[model samples]
Every structure is written in structure tokens, then in C-alpha cells.
Target: MINAESSAERTVAGPLRAAWGSRAEASALADVLLPPSTALPGFADPERWPPNALTRLASVLDLARSERGTPWPQPTASQYARFFRDGDGDRTDYETPVFDLDHRLTRAVLAALVSRDDDLLDEVADGVLLLCERSTWCWPAHEEHHRLRGAVVPDPDLPYLDLGAGVVAAQLAWLDHVLGDRLDVRWPGLRARVRREVRVRVLDPFTSRHDWHWLGLDGDVHNWCPWICGNVLVAALRLVDDPADRARIVADTVRAIDRYLAALPPDGSVDEGFEYWWNGACRALEALDLLEHATGGRLTAADVPVVRETVRFPRLMHLGGPWYVNLADARALPSGGQPWHVPQEWARRVGDRDVALHAAAQRSTAIPDTAELGRALRDLATPLPDHPAEPLVGSVWLPGTQVGLARATAGSTAGPTLVIKGGHNDENHNHNDVGSVIVAIDGVPVLVDAGRPTYTKQTFSADRYDIWTMQSSWHNVPEVRGTPQGTGRDHRARDVTVEDTADRFQVRLDLAPAYRVPALRSWWRTATLHRDRQRVTIEDSWDFADHGDSRSTLHYLLAGDVVRDGPGRLVVHPVSGARATLVAWNPSLASAALTVRELDDPLLRTVWGEKLTRLELRLPDPARGSLMIMVEVCA
Candidate 1:
């Protein structure tokens, strides 16, 4: 519901205005900015590190040793032109090399630091030189020149400061800060090349340009604001020796970050879902940490109210290990691509032990492969706490985002859990699923959301909803009069309410507003989780203006192998090690049919395998009727 006008009004003097308001504060911050020598951690000199920091980096050193002779994947011009030439948006062809180059540099730099080996210095110099030789660091999808002009390839003179560019800048900056002196000993002018490339590609454009949409000046901010700012801030602090330039970059980045913080829901719910929280909210928190460090505690994340509230978002949306309330474009199983250490540190700063534990658990469980060298270095250097990791155990209701999660027991994923959302269709990475619900049993999704498919040209274009995964019929919601939920902010749930008690938790909302059916009056939907019975129930009571050949259908996308037991009853077998569940509906009101939807996208196949089953309850007559569905774990 936030537009440019409203966001602009709030950005004038938002929550972070007190942190760095006037020119005096800006000058004070500049006066105390960390010098280039100590801007980042002393990975170059590990003797001053914490006791176990070097030990933790042993794996990275080994990885560096293992890939010592492997050939780096080199990107070609054809790969870069694939998008502009044929409308292909798959970024793996060109991005794989970018990632490989960064990873190689990161591993070599850390390995040399850990083992004090001069042999690895040659590989490090190669990475730095290779980065400097690249035509563009920006990903092809983010390359605006293709859309702005008819150019097929990036212009060497104009660098697009997108996420990929920011990531490379930070990577080069960190490595230079850590190994610049060492490189000078052998590679000579390579350090200067890195400095020049970073200045041109990331720092110069970031500071000089005012029209970049991600800056949030025009109130169109999302995860990109904090993510790019955080990375750009790293490059600025580490590479920019000029105090005034550093200060201006820091101040401008802070204002943009403040705009992002102001735009967040007060309850700290991320409509982009759990995956983006690390990139969006956690990145801002990391930026705050950098500011606090540079200013000697003048600015702290603890001073921000939204930071404290937003740190627990991942925990709130968690549905056991690797399973979250996968709404919007977020997948059910997270890629863990972002840095977990950032959120872990944020949780510790905000004094939330549960969230801290959850983040640390994520760090421990997921495979660590990141192109952000700053976060990667920090992840290796930071030590995890000495406690077991657990999911957010109990029920939570975030009224700001209108999301409610209910579980049968506290601190244990023993039974059923119900997650319901009553948000608009125009949310970030929005899917036309205004009144969708997810049912999880012991942390495994039974009645599921299909998440998202691999990104293509159609993913973010005008034809976005044409993708079946982005449609309402694929979600656990009702389609009235053969019309699916509409898209946009106006098409959203109405009169949403949540009630959490000892024996039961319930969410009530009217979803009629989400549809565009002229014959529809109101579709009142109630989803309840009975903790005592350990069952989840979804009831849709809809009213129609006329009975004239109108019919509505309730679509429930179920994961795993689905078997129809008999009329009005179906059983879902376990998928991906989760337990099975029984889905039962009233036969008197509607007939049931199961349709198998085969997964073709490689991305979706990773989570749901080759296929997913959709169970539809068809209301033969849709004048005024109700449909009730109950899902319970089978004994």
C-alpha cells in the first residue's frame, strides 16, 4: 500500500534522522571514520584474531588448496548478449564465472592469510587482474542498457551500479584491504588496478549518480536499497582514502537505508518473505554495525526500534529446518545465499536469544558459498555460540503484515502448524494469493505453496501472472465464479482478524474483494488450528448475488504423492522426509478431484521434485454455500 508520495513524506524525517540528522553530525561521523588500515578485520594479520578464528577458516584454506589448479570459468560475449538477443534471462552462463572469480579470490586471500604461504599469492593476483579485465560486473538481467538503449553489450565507459557490481566492488575492496601490501610485494601495480576499477565501477557511479532507482529518493525501495548500500558502503569505507568523500558516501547511504527502514511495516514483517530478510533487513543492520564501528559507537543498531523488531522476522516465518512460510517469490527451502552471520549478530545486538540461536543454526546447517567477500570473511572469523539451534516454537500474529502462525505445542514441532496471510496482491515479489494459507506437519509442508519457478523474462514483466505458479489457483485459496484473485493493491483481503487462545488459533478474513466476479457478494474465509485436537481446518463460506450457472472451486496444492482414499477424503504421502497427512472435505457441498501438476522448471524441481498434486473441491452450485477442509497428520 506504500506509494512514492507517502514514502517521500516519511523519508524527510524518519526514525534514523536522529542518528545522523544535521551537517554537524555528518562532520562528526566523518571525523571519526575508520582509517583505511583498520577499515576491515585484520585477516592479513591473523595473530590478533580471536582464538578459534584461524581454526574456523581451515575449511576455506582446504578448499583453496583443492581448487588450486582448476581452470576458472571465463565468460564470453555471447553469454552476455543472450538476454538482449533472444529474451533469455537465465544468468547462470555469465554469472557462474563472476561467482567463480570471486570465490577463487576469496579462498586464495583467506588461505594465504591462514597459512602464511607465498605460493597462493600468484592465484590471488590472477583473480584481481581478471576482475579488472572484465567488461562489466553487473549481471545481464540488471543491465539497463539493453532496455534503455538497443545496445546488446555493456558499454565500457558506463558502469551500471547494480547488485552484481556492488558485490564485486566489495569483494575487491576487502581483498585489497587485506592483501594490498602483500600484492605490492609480488604483483606490483595490481593493487592500484583494483583501486581504479572499484572507483569507476561502484564508488564513482554510486556517489555521482542521483537518478538510480534503488537509492529510494523517489520512494521506490526494496531489498535492493539496503543490499546495494551495504556493499557500496564496504567499498567506500575500505577504498576511499578521502575523508570528505567517505563521509558523503556514508551519509547518503544512511539516508537511503533510513528510507528503507521507514518503509518497513512496524511489526517488522517482510512481505518478500524469509529469504529476502537477510538481504533487506539484515543488510541494513550490518550497515548500522559498520557505521557504529566507524563512528566509535556514535550510531548503534540498538537505537533503532525497527531493527530490534525486524531481527526476529526469520524466526517468526520459520517452519522447522529449511521450511518457511514460503509466500511471494520466496521458495519453501531457502537458498541460504545471504550471510547468516549478519542476522546472528543482529539478533545478539537486539537481545533476542531465540532469533540468535535460529540464525546460528542456519549458519551451521546450510552450505556456505557467497560472493560477498566481506560477509564471507566475517562468517569465517565470527564464532558461533555454544547452544543447540531450534525453530521459533510458539504462535505469533504480526498484525502489520496480517500474518498468523499457530502450532500445536511450544518449543516442539510435534504436530500440525497453520500459517495464514491476509495481505494484498501487490506485495513485494507479489503473487495473486491474497488469502492463502499453508499447513505444515512437524515442520514439513503437506498442503503447500508451490513457491516460485526459475527466473525468466516473464518472471518480472507485464506477463508475470501468466506463470501458473504466480496465479491464485495454485495457492490454497478459493476461486470464485471461475475467476481467480486479481492482482494489485486494491485486490486484497478485508476485515482480517486473528485470535490466539489456549486451545485454538484462528484467522478470519473476507476474500471477496480479491476477486473480480460481478456475481460474487462476499467470500468469508476462516482458518483455524485446534491445538487440542492437533488438526488444521479451513472453511470458506461464500455468498453470490445470483445462482445462474456460477461455480466456485477451492484449490489445495499438496506436496508429496497424493492418494485418493474415497469420496471427500485424500491422503498425502511423505515428501522429502516429512510425515503424511489426510485431507478431508464435505462431499455434500462439493465434489473432489485431484490433478497432478508436473514440475518443469529446474528451480522448482529442486524442492518439489518432478510433480505436485492439486486437490480441488468444486462447488457445483455457487449461489450461497460453504466448504470446509480439515488436514490432520495420519496415525
Candidate 2:
């Protein structure tokens, strides 16, 4: 656990302000920050970037060049009004066009810079002008004006700076920095228009407003604090010509980031899980990197201890290729929407060799296909050091979030791995899955946490838990008295503990707090992974107000093809290259039934094919108040 006093004292913004708040510091920053054209990549000369940079980035350039004549899609008024028409709202209608414009402009800039193609300049200018002419940069789902004032369309006068807005603003800022001079020579006043549009849409709204919830001025902060602020920071530093204004904007960003840093647990675990780490923690690292560079190493990650502590989180959570411990609403197979360079660079900065190599392994030779131009540019300029791609494997215990992963082997994917979680039900993108466990054999999941489906109107609404995927019944936990676990922070695990020894690793949790069962008094679950035996055991002992708690059922969501061996045992055939696992339980105490859940959601299909199986064990007479289940790999 992090010391309370140390956490109180560790403030990123406090030290930053003390060192760089003055006009002198701002001037120093301005002097050190090279002009966009002269900065990293040096306006795309072969001497500036790595020899393989252009060739690696050619895929993106070629795609954009092929689509040069394609007109940018525009969201209709009806499409923008879909949110009010539906309860949850459709974000794709707004995001599809906005992000397409972002991608096109980013590609045009990269192509022009790399190939020095004059034809691409016109495409770049057209993309920028069209973006400026758009109704609003903010996604309909994120527009507060609609909820606050019942306005169907975005208020032109009120520019809401959201994730989309910040991204667009940064895109324009980077493009201008690199291609502004050339645009000035060919297309008069175009660069000025880009500056005007960005300042009005993102910068003015960002600095002038204190009420934006994402700023974290009043209360709780999440990924948005760092993700949005990081983008805005890039825009401010590059486009805001005045040193005083730039300093003030950067100062606000620093303080905002402090809230996010303060919220991080002692172990640097993201309760939101592995997928959001890219947007939340990685963005914070990028922000710090920018600060370090702009200040000439005056402010560094060394100032913040948590930065080093959290840098290895993604690496720690990895369970081989395309499989992560999908704890929350994150997909099992991440879309890789964000670039890998962010973590690679962060690992390099913090001297984490294992994490750096892991990040390098995920890195595509091509410039990452992301809307964030800043990320792509930095990735293009920096060459990844040669290292064998190997995932760190063994055992990891994140006490802050009460998550544990135990493997049968130290550094090889030759045996089964067991993962368990004991967090509250109200975690970010939460699933009611306290005291849930996942077992993977040879790096592929057998007993799985069935990750969430595609987002729709209800994903974030009051009816969020109504979705079956968000309920405890669909997870790998027991439903007490025919009732699943409840939602909220109060619905959480208690007395969680982890024990690690040379021969075994185990985790224990009092899971009664996670459910609201009238007859339930206590439910203690202990999951142990015996290393030499390559076996995992789950022992649940419970006492209830009523001794006959016969209604409770233990649920296990299984991936791969399942074959019933008998009433007490099931043989699981892994979907891919993983070995099969055998699940066994006490047949005298309970009876087993299998149900297939056909997955129709596009996102879920990507990870678990056409269907997954849910195995339910109904306790015939829970009067004994104890049950033991064993899962072992079948050679």
C-alpha cells in the first residue's frame, strides 16, 4: 500500500509550478521548444528520421494517396439528433465522419512531408478547411449542451472541448507546424485559418472554462483528465505563439494531470483494466515526456515516483498474444486504436527493460494507425532498439486493485496461469464480478472473463447493468439465493489477501460483501495455483443465516469447445493453439448443466468466435456451507 503521507506530498504540478510558473521559465520553454518544422523528424528529411521510417510508414501514405479524390463524409442533422431519439445515443454517426477527416488530414500531412508530393498539399488543405466548417468537433454522446439545455444540435457559440475536439485541435497544430510554411507559399491565409479554427474550437474553450468536468477541478477524475489534457498540451505548446498564454495553458494542464496522478493506487494499477491503460497512463507518460523535453530535462519522471511504478502495468497484465485479463468493459482483443510507441518510449524513459521490449514487440513497423498525429510523428522519428520479443511471465499481485496472476512456470508459456480479481462492482466500465477467476492453459483462456460487447445507447446509461454481460450471473462467480452481485462501491470484496511461495500462489477474498443476499452471512473464496502440479483449485466456504441456501449456483464462463465427460467433469478444447483443461467438481453436492451463448455482437465475436459456453453448478444442499472445485490442464 502507498503511504498516505507520501501520496499527499507527491504532486506533479506543485513542483512543476514552483520551477516553471514564472515568465522567465515560460520564455526558457519557448526558446527550447523548436519550431514545428525544425523539431523531431526535421520536416521529413532522410537524415533526420530513421532509414526505415518512410518505408515503414508507406502503408498509411499509400492508403491516403489512393483515397485522395474521395470526398469527406458529413454527418446529417438527423444523424446528430439520434442521441435524443434514442436513450443511449449512437456515437458512430458523429465519430465516423469526424475521425475520418482526422485520419485523412494526418495522412495527407505525413505523405506530403515524406514524399514531398505537391498534389497532397491540396488534399491536406481541403481536409483542414472541411474540418473547420463542420458543425461541431465534439461527439454527440459527449455534448453536454444537449443534456444541459435540451438542444438537439450543438450550440455554435458554445464550443465543447472533448476528446474529439482535443484530437482535432492537435492534428491541425502539428500539421501547421510541419506544413504551414509550404501552405503559406502556395495557399495564402490557409495556415492562419487553421490557427483561427483550432484556437476558437479547442484552446479558448479549454483555458476559458473551469466547469468542464474532465478538468477534474471539483471532484473525481479518470482517463479523460490525462487523455484530453495531453492532447491540449501539445496544441498549446505548438500553436499558441504568446509565451504567457502558452505558460498559463500548460500550467492548467499540469494541475489537471495532478488529479489523475493522485488518484493512482500505490501499485499503479488501473481499475479500468489493461485496455484503458493506453489512453490513461500512457497519455500521462507522454505528457511528462513533452514536459521533460520542453524544459530541457528540468522536470522529469523522477519527480514522480508513481511514474516508474506504473510503467510496467501493461506488461504485467499481458497473457500472451491477443489475450489480456479483460476485467472491465475492455475487449479481450484490443483494437490497438492507440499507438504502442507511447509505452515503449515511457519504458525507455523509466528504464524498464522488460516493459520496453514488450512494447517493442507490439510495435508495427508502420507508423501506428491512430488519429493522434503527435504519437505517429514521435514514433516515426524514434527507432526501436533491437530486442527479442518476450512477455514477462511468472506471478504478479496488484494489491491496489486486488488483482493477482499466477503461472505454473517462471518465464515460459508451458503451463497454466490463474488470474483472480476482488475489486468493487462499481469500477470504471465495471462488471459485477468480484472474486472472479480466469484460468488459461498455455497462454490461451479456458475459464474466461467474457469481455463486453459493442457499445450502444445503454452502455453508459442508468440501465448499464441491465445488460447481461454486466451482471454477476454472466461472470465467473456465484449467484447467491438466485441473485447476482449488486452494483456500487459498497458492493465489493473484503479481507482480500495474496500469498506467494516457491511452490504455490494463492489469493483469498470474503466475497459476501459483493452480493446482497438476505440469508448469506459470509462467503470466503480461496484460489490456489500449485506450481509443480500445474493445477488450480477454488475452495468456497460460506455460512448463511439459513443453513439451506440451496438456491445459490456457481457460474463459470468457458471459452473454446467444451465436451461433457460426466456430471462432475468437462473437457475444454481451446479455440486456437492452447491445450485443453479439465474442470471437476463434487458431484454429490451439486449437479452441472451447460448452456451455449451465441455471440452476435461484433466485438465479442472477434475474441471468442461464434459462441461461448456457460457452465452452471447448482448446489443440491448447501447445508454444509463449503464447496471445492478443481481445474487441471489435460496433457
Candidate 3:
């Protein structure tokens, strides 16, 4: 194991220090971020706070109070380990209880504080103590650590600082910070246990260890780094009393955040898709918000350009209507009622009204829970400006992941839009798609990506690629010599370039390297969007230096409804008058035969709410040849 003390020491003078600049800036940021140990702010009484300000807050508390009658679910070691031994079947049952408990305790405490319901104070006190005393507040995977080959996770008595566990502790700290005076009134030791558990699981372990994958100390960074660090900031700011100790934790958090930032491409494209972007980047923003609040204004996302760019990913990733271009293990289609506060709030921080407006246009008036009192409070403080949806301008090319976005007009959801992707198969949540594309007309999707299935043991195991939804065969790409694209960072597209204009959009990708076959020479696909023409033409050309009879099969995935129109044309019928006509080129190939296959995966069911259909184009395989597919949308 690495000497965590040394690692923590380096954090003070390392990349984070460089991001902060100078010893003075670092010291000042640490001061504002940790704030001298003091009493946490109390929850303002709803009666006198603001009119209807606590309405959503009250609703959250009411739901929790209602659920109080439901028995708290218990999780056992066997139930937790079932996934490791048997797969993903029973793990959710074990997990349901944890979420229920977390929600239960959170609601009880918020009700006691927000409504000042003295009747629920004892329940709040008991809830906090029970959570703090749970054998494991973390998920089965984190506590068991079965990911590594033949590795046995140490059975520690202390509550783990995993994402789930860390968030729970952070909430407990908030409870203690605001109502410690009240909680202390009941058990006295309850507040002390909150602090001790946080130290034992989060602070001490985080500052001293580099073993956590999310810490990014080993050079690999992803969503977890920012997610868990956010909770650390929550716990440390409200619970850790010692200034030096708090600074140490904050330094590690800053250092960890640097890892998440470092993982992002310079162009700010999230290859893991927008759903994970929300899960990760949004959480990071929350941490930054806390840091900004604690430190007055000396340090925050406003000081960093990359932070602004990173937070802008969600809006730019939109793939026309009803989708945000989610790829990989992310949901194939973005759900309705997406959260807008992160982008809206981040845009306001950076003073970018355009982005702020984009988020505002799509913002919903719904609120999920008051458990995240910090974010709720921030939401209340930063009132979003009402902004209407605008047409999307030109096109966006994220060179890092080779993901391209082109729309007919700026913010035109129901217009001609094309999202093309050509990156390696190994990403945060990878899928083996080298040359894949999606086509949407007037916000109606004609060609789509089979994003993912309900996660199970196979989803994250060595057999991950075995799942059809994760393979290139299931994507908008072709299979060469009956072999699909390989999975790994090394298995990526090469020689990718894009050209965009007011009326014409073209993306060219050299996908020869992604396949692992000696006989494979070169495979290239180009997607051209004629904006005014409302037409998209996808051309695939391939050749082998020394081969024949290659046998390549082209495929396309579609949602909603589709039907055969003619010899070389098929029409897709959506809910309204929005219809897309697909025309296959190369006369002979376009007229060849078309077959339909249904995907019965839950992921597809979740997105389409029904089984999605796949269209197959059986092109005559000459070993070395070309194929073309066209999709034209009519106004």
C-alpha cells in the first residue's frame, strides 16, 4: 500500500496546488473551503422562512412521514454477496433496504427541522443513530470488492467511505451540524458517533489511502472521483472540527477533483454519455458549490475555465428530440423530466446566459427530495431565468471521443439532426461501437443506438461483450467476416475528421483499426447531413489487400414505428405527422432483402417502453466493396 500520509502531503503541493496557483492562493482557498470550525447554520423555520418556499420541502417530508409506517429493510452479508456468487438477481432486494433507510432517516430529520415538528425529533435522533450504527452503510460491491480477480475484500468494522456510504455520512453530518444541539439533547453520544464514523470511514481512509479507484491517484479517473469527493466535502465541512484536519481532507478532495478534471478531454466531450455526465459532473458541481460557499469567493468553478467547459457537456450532447446522445452503458434514450439545475446553475456561475437559457428552457418544476438540503438551498438561492429553447447552431465536433453533433438549426429539436460517434471501445462505460450514428428528423428518431440493458452481473463482468446490446453487431455498423469490433481502449477509430457548413455537414472516420482481423484491410464510413435537403446519406466503403468473399452485414436500429415503402425505400412513422423515409443506395444492395429482428432486452424496453426493432441490410459480399444507406425526412 502507498503511504497515504505522503500522498496527502503531496496533495497540498501537487496538481491541486498548481490549479490553485501560488502558496497564498492555496492557503486562502483552503481557508474558505474548510472554514474555521464553527457552528453549522440551522434550518430556517418554514413558518417564517419564506412563503411556499418550503412547499416542495414539506412535500418531501410528507412522503417520508408516510413511508415511516413501512418497515425498515435489513441487508445481510449473504444477500449482499449473492451477486458476486450468483450474479445480479437478488442484489437489488438487498439494496432496496439501504435506499429505504437512507430516505427514511433523511425525511424524518428534514421534517423535524424544516417544519419544526417537535413530534418527529426523537424519530430523527433514533434514525441518525441507527444509520451510524449499521454494520455497512455501503453497497454490496464496494464492501465486498469482488471486482479484482480472486481478491477478498477486507471485512472492516468501520463504515466504508464508498459512494453510498459517503453520501449517508454527509447527510448525517448535516443532521448533526444543524440539529446536533437537538440530537445531542437525546443521546449526547449520537453527535460524537457521527464524527467518529465519518473519520473512521471517510476522512482517515481518504487522506491516507490511494487504493480507492475514484481517488485518481493511480492515473485513472472517472465519475466516482468527483461523486465521492463531493460527499467528503459535505462531511468534512459540517463535521470535521479541527482546521488542519479539515484542510487535509479538503486538500485530498481538491486533489481527487483534479483527477476527474484530468480525465476529461480538452474538447469537453463525455464518451460515457450525458446520463453519466449528469451523475458525475453534476455531483462535482455540488462539491464546488459547497467549496465556494465555505470559502466566501476565493476559490470556485468560476476561477477555472475547464470547470465551465466540463459543466457545459449536457446541453451540447443533445441529439435532436427526446435524446441527449447517451451512448455506452448509459440509458439508450434520455428520460423526460431531466434535471436542469446543474447546467443552469453552472452557466449562471460562469455568466453564460445562452447555456443558462438552454437549460432553463428544458427545466422542469419538479423536485426529487430534500435529502440534499445543500443543493435544495442552493437552488432556492439561485433562481433560474426563464429562457426559451433556441435553435442549435452549426455543428459540434468532440475530437477526443470523435463524437459529432449536427443540427438543422440552433435549438431546433424537431429538425434534421445527426449524431455520429467513432471512438475506442474502452471508456468510462464502454461499448464496442467504432462507427455508429443516429439520425433524427424534426425530432423524430429513425436510426438509434441500443444504449444498454438493465445492469446485471454480465453488464460488468468478463462476459460484458457477450451481451448483444453492448456489441458492434447491434449498433449502426456492419460486421466484417462475421467478426465484431473488439473491446478496449486500444480498439479505437483512427484518422477521424469532420467538415461542417451552414447547409452541409460531413463526418469521415477511418474505422479499419478497430477490428482485430488479419484479413481486414480498411473500413471507412462517412455520414453527410444536407441540412436544407433534410437528407442524411451514410456511405460505407471497405477493401482487403489480399482477400475475397468477406461477407459483411450492415445493420440499423430504430425506435417508434417503421414500414417498407418500396424496393429501396422504407418509411418510419412516428406519433405525429413526423415521418422519415430511409433510402438504401447502390441500387442492387438497397433492393436486396430486408429483415427485422426484435431486441427483448429490458434496457430497450425501458427506453422504447417496448421491444425495439432492428433492420438488417444483406449486402452482396464481394470480400472488397462498398455499401450506402440513406435516410431522408420529409417536411
lDDT of 3 at 141: 61
Candidate 3, residues 70-141, lDDT tens digits: the string is 566566666676666774444575676777677677667667776455657777766776776676667766
Q: Number of clashing residue pairs in every model? A: 0, 1, 12
Q: Candidate 2 on 1-635: residue-level lDDT in tens?
A: 22122333324344335444452244545555544333323444545988888888888888889978787767778888887777657767766766777877788888888766778898888888888888788888788887789999878788888888888887887787777778898789887887888899898988777777776654567899898998888888777777667777776677777668767886889988999888898888888887776655666665466777788888788777767778898876677745777778778777788888888888777675454677778888878666575766689999888999988886666678899999898787889999999988888888888888877778888988888888899999998878889999999999988899989999999999888776778889999999979899998887787665347889999988999887789999987788888999989887788999999988888899999999998865554467788888875
TM-score of 3: 0.90
What global local distance difference test value does model 1 have? 0.82
Q: How well does each candidate superpose onto the true structure, as a TM-score?
A: 0.95, 0.93, 0.90
lDDT, ranked from best to worst: 1, 2, 3
CA lDDT, candidate 2, residue 578: 83
Candidate 1, 379-463: lDDT as tens digits:
7666756657485668999887788898898777777999999989988899999889999888888888898987776788899
Ranking by TM-score: 1, 2, 3
RMSD of each: 2.5, 3.7, 3.3
What is the lDDT of every predicted structure here? 0.82, 0.80, 0.69
Top TM-score model: 1
